[model samples]
Target: MKDLLGFGLRGRLREGYTAADFRADALAGLVVGIVALPLSMALATAVDAPPQHGIYT
Candidate 1:
């Protein structure tokens, strides 16, 4: 399972993830989430499902 999803924090820490990196990553994630929320809802709507399913998904 770990191999399948290779989001390794230990490796990132070893590679020196600093405060600036955290800030940048956080901002980037926020932007992506903002865009994805409506896109996900649109996808659910396209399939005739409730918009909330996008959040669960």
Candidate 2:
């Protein structure tokens, strides 16, 4: 459904941003960062940049 992937957030914000939404989004972001950080660091290394720059990016 469109709501599952995209438009739900805009609609929700139009209504209100509640505490539950903040907690859920924060948890999702934490999980995504844990999974993506290493891959990004590797990408930075392949590009000959320092690893920390990947986080800055």
TM-score of each: 0.66, 0.50
Per-residue lDDT of model 1, residues 6-44, tens digit only:
788777877999999999999999999999999999999
lDDT of 2: 0.88
Candidate 1 clashing pairs? none
- List where candidate 1 sits over 4 angstroms from the true fold: 1-15
Worst 10 residues of 2 by lDDT: 1-10
The per-model lDDT (C-alpha) reads: 0.89, 0.88
User: How big is the positional error of residue 39 in model 1, measured in Å on the Cα after superposition?
Assistant: 0.7
